[model samples]
Every structure is written in structure tokens, then in C-alpha cells.
Target: MGMKVRGISYYDYMLLLFVGGVIVLSFPANLLRVWGVPFFRGPYYDVIFVIFVVLALCNLWMSKDSPLPSYYFAATLLLFSTMVFAIGVIRGNENVIAGMKYFALPLIVYMLLVGRRFVLSFYSSNFLWSLVVGSHVFCLLFYYAFLYGRVYPGIGVPSISFAALFFLAKQKYFLLSVSLLVVLLEGKRSLLLALLITMVFMRMVRLSVVGRLIYTILGIGILVLSMYLGLSFLAGITGSAIVNRINLLNPFSGSFDILLGSSGRAGELLSYFRGKDTLELLIGSGSGFTYEWQLGYASTQEGEIKGYFHMTPANYLAAGGLLGLVPFVWMMLLPFRAGALKESNDTRTVAFGLGVFCVVQSFFGFNLATDAVSIIFIIGPMMLLSEQRRPGGATALRSNSLERTS
Candidate 1:
């Protein structure tokens, strides 16, 4: 029995190891919270979502010889929303309009890869990795230095994440390193800590001797650099200060318990978005909410709150209203696309890597909710698990030959 376990193929084990990547990556993403009505909000939330959707679709067409529905994951999410709407209806959340809005085009389709052809397709694999790395870098750069005269870098559509996704794909250590440092120096204490835990855990579990050596050197280098930056760039912050800031999100006894347990922001959102004098608030305002709800479009009021959102659920509410939100509740319950990857070498590794990244990033961000971004984040993995697949091979199940777009 022990020998049998050992005999599991590297690809299969790789598939399993993929989960580690997902856990490490997802903590920084955003939300899809549903209350009396469905609403969402955040900084750069839409940018992340759009990017996720686009990658998912690209992955769908990229997937080879698979009969998966490509749309099953998204459809399932939409269907789940319907069920949740039933609950809202019963409770008379008066948010049925909010719940039902998600059905418009509530389907996600993933790419299907054929055989081991893509297993070692270095170009494609590295391309995707580059996208991840570049996005990470761009985001960090945006957070720290700003870009193209924009206060927020990735906020621009023809911006960093987009530029890197298809064009400049590969593992960019420079960008990655910069991100690590920036997150540390900036006050995003939660993100830095989460990433540290994730990196250490991965090293402990699967990093090879060479990888570990490289990583140890890398870690020491980063710490030393951070110390320099702390003294030069961020004079006020200390190691203890960094640790304390990160602790706010830790769920620890002293610092964590009373966490967002500090409800000023939460209370404000409820009052501003969910309070009584709503015109179409129940059904939701429109198909995308930003800062300004009294006025259409994603803008916010002038002053301190400008460019920021008070109501968190504004994204969903804006896109579909309760009328559309109903079709997406419990949407994530579907196994991540990795669970549906076929038993093969190249497909398994690529699927696992992509799936894990999407899951981790989406959880921490919210790119999973955008149409373009959701392509890779939510549906790309599903491409491997669509209804096109069955007990037998997809070739055997083909009725009409169709070239699905990658």
C-alpha cells in the first residue's frame, strides 16, 4: 500500500500540490457578500475582476481536446444564485430584485487542453506565469510609485496587468521581489504577513534543496533590503510596527479579535447603500457600482471619500441588481477547475498552477467577479471540467467539430 501511494505520478502529485499555491495566493482578494441584497465594493476591485474573466476564456480555448461545457462553472454559479434568491424571497429581504440580476449571461467557459502536448509547452506555461508575476509587480509598483500619471496604476485598462497577461508572460523575479519589498514597506500589513506564511510553508513542504538555497539567499537579501528601505524610504516604520500592522488581520487574541470588529466602515456602508430612502436600491442601481451611487457610473462624492467605496456590495448590485445577483450565490461551491482537470501530465500541471493562482488571487482580490478577469480566474479552470467532458473521452463525445476560441 505504501509503495502504491509512492507510485502516484508526479503530475498527479503536482495536482495535489497545486492546492498549496492556491491557499497562499488567494488571501489578498475581495468579496461577493450577499445581505438583504447583493452588493460589493473595494479598491481596484473591478480591475481585478475584469482581468480574471479574460484569462479564464483564454485558458478555455487553450485547453485541448476536452468536452467540458466551459460554461458549467459559471452556469452553476448563476443557478446557485437563484437558490439563494429563494431564501431572500422567503425572508422578504425585498431584495429579490437584487438576487435575480445575475442571470443575464451567467455562464463561464474554460479552455480544454489535449493530451501531454501542453505539458512542457514552455512558451505557454511561462507566458501565464509571467502574467501573474507582471501583474504582481505592476500592482506593487502602482501601490508604491504610481504610474502613467495615475494615482492607481492597474486602474488604467490598457495598464500593467493587461499588458503583461498576453504579451509579457513568465516568472519575473524583479517584479516579484519589488512586490515583496513594497508590501512590506507599505502599510498593507495583512498582505505581507499572508504572503510570508505562504512562502515559508511552500518552502517547508516542496522546495528542493536548490530552490531552498535560492530562496534562503533571496529571503536574506529581501530582509536586508527592507531594512535599508525602512531606514531610507520608510523611516517611521520598524519591524515591530510592521508586525503590529499585520497583526490587525491575524485573528489573534488581543489584536485580531476586536478586528474589523471595529465597525465604523462597515456601519457606514450599510447606512449609505442599504438604508431606507432607496429608489432602485433593492433591485440595485445598475450594472456596475463604484463610489457614486446617487449619480450613475462608478464615481464617488468629492472630498475625503472620493475614489473610495463605502458600500462593499456595490459591484454586484451595480452590474445586475438583486434581479441579477440571484444567479451567483454559492457559485464558488463548485470545485475549483483543478478538481475537474483530466488525468494527464501537462494538462494537470498547467491546470493546477493556473487554478491555484486564480483561487488565491481571487479570494484576496475579487477579480473572480469581473467578466474579463473571471475568464481565467473562474471559468478558465472550468474549461477543464465542462459538460463537454463525460465518463469517456471528449473525442468520442463529439457530435459537431467546433474550434473553441483560446
Candidate 2:
């Protein structure tokens, strides 16, 4: 592991150390099940969850030679959050705690992974690509089965076969088609839309002509398959009535027409914040409001069954508040910018899309600590492979420098 980057060779055991920590955390998160920690938890089966966290850490630590962004943004965000929590404490407001979940994701990821080489590591590129596609396939299939009433106790359908098809079936039109099916079938339009937009954007603005053509053909096939399956899934779940209530997914649903319903919650906050010229839009939302808002926030008043799962970007605003989220958001775009500024290939393109996907996924149904690491996060970052030649000046794999983190 000894390699000189910017004249530093301390990377010798960083990867091992990181992997070891992950292995320890991973076991508790997976094996101990109900006993490990609070905010994060999962069944004994979620090895992927713990593995990714480790990967993210290792990716950063290993990439020690690369200078990451100044931590000002992340630091400020944490500061704002801490101050808000402090205020909430004095007033005994609980809503500030509600911000915990929303605030945790990027903070933890950035605090651990940012400014690290693993993110751009060539060794992790391939792993990340596999991670994104594989996790989506699993979530997509499981969700499809659930909607169709086909989900039993275990993996439904031929997961292995589906996985093969998933990787091999990459096509623009096909991806779009399949994405639409997944949206309707799983009733998770956010993820479906994220994939669709990503694939289309990649094809039009990012990929080569040959890649686009291949992706298009596959896209068509996936569309047809999705249509067939999605219809059946809907039929098994809610029947034609799903069509009637589909409009409710808009967030400004029928239920939000009245006072403080999810729709009007914003109006409430805006009204509350109105006439406040002295407020810091760039820094924080004051305390005591967390309890008043969350236990009582409009995301709930809107009649949402799961108030915390609001699809609005407003959640980002309200939960972590402004100051806390700014740098986190910026840090998120760091990789995409790096890819664009630096010459990259399909792997970097794919990573860009997945990073966007994870961002979008957060706005919807995901939890703070599902007790597992999300597959998208893992494979998305792990997929980069080595691009440099071997040491001793040889060009063979592993014989030379091996991979480089993108």
C-alpha cells in the first residue's frame, strides 16, 4: 500500500484500518440486529449497508493525497444545527430533534468521506457502478412484487437473472421505459423520475453516439416489460382506484387545501418568518421551533400519514434549516464537478447520475437509520477501477500502479 502522492506515503495502512473499522461497525449493524445502535439499524441480512459506510471512509482516507474542499460549509452547517438544538433545549422544544434524521445523512457522509481519494479512486469506480445498478434492481424488484402481491417472504422473481438483465439491459429509451414502470409499479415516482432524468441527461449531454444508440434500444425493451408488470402490480394492489388518487402524489393534494395541511404548512412558516428582516437566511432557523414544527410541523398538518416523508425540498429547508444544509449540498456536487472539470468516462458519468439519485432518494421515503447501508451509496462510489500503469513502469494490471480513484 506504500505509494507516494504529493510526497506523502502515510497511506500504507489507511485502507486496512478503515476496512477494519467498517468490519466492526458492519457486524454490529448486521449481526446484533436489534441491539447495535439507535438511529441506525437493520436486519442481520444487510451486509451491504455496513460495507458501503466503510467504503466511503476508506475511499476518503485512501485518497489522502488529494486536497478536499474547505470544511467551512460543513462546519457552518453543524454549527447552525448545534446552536438550534441548544435553543430548542432551553425551551424544551422537540421539533429540533426531528431535524436529526434529515441533518444526519450528508453530515456523516461528508465528515467521513469528503476531501478523500476513494471517492475519485479508480479502484472503486467499477464497484460504484455495480452498486448503483444492483441496489436499484433489488429495490425495484422487491417493490414490484410488493405492489403486485407477489412479494413473498424472500427474494421474489429470479434476482440473479434480473440482475444480469439489469446490467446487460442498459439502454436510454429502455431505461426510461423501465423507469416509468418502476415509478408506477412501486408507487415511488421520485426514484423512477431520478433514473429517467439521469439516463436521458447522460445520453443527451454526456455519452457518446454509440453508447446512446445501445442505451435507446434497451430502453424500449425495458419500457414494454415495465408496462406489462406495472399494470399487473397495480391490479393486485389497489385496482383502478389508484388512478383516481394518483394526483395526490403532487404534495399539494386534496387534503392540503385547508389550513396547515402539508400544502399550507409552508404558508404557515413563511407567514411566521415574514417581516423578519434581521433573520439569517444563510445561517440557521432559531430553536424551540423544531418541536413546534415537527411534532407540529405542517408536513403533518397537511394530513400526511408519514409526516416525515414529505416529498418537498422544503424538508431540507425546514429540517436542517438553511445554514446547516448549504455546504452539505455543495459537498454533494463536488464529485460531479470533479468529473466534469477533469476528463472522465462512462464510469464518472454513471457516478454523477447515482450521486444525483441518492440526493433525490433522500427527499422521499428513506429513513435516517434504517439500520443498514443503502446499496446505492456503496456501489455508486465503489465502481471506479484502476487506470494507471503498474509500478516498475509496466502497463499490466496490478503489476503497475493499478487503479486511480476518480
How high is each candidate's TM-score? 0.41, 0.50
Worst 10 residues of 2 by lDDT: 153-162
What are the runs in model 1 whose C-alpha is more than 4 Å off? 1-124, 127-268, 272-330, 343-366, 387-406
Q: Over the stretch 129-227, how does candidate 1's per-residue lDDT look in tens digits?
A: 444445555444544453233321122221122212212123455655544554454444323333443343222213456775888687768766664
Candidate 2 on 289-398: residue-level lDDT in tens? 43123232444453322323233234444434565456445544543432432224544554455454445444443322231223223322422221221132112222
Clash number by candidate, in order: 79, 50
Model 1 TM-score relative to the real fold? 0.41
- lDDT score, candidate 2: 0.40
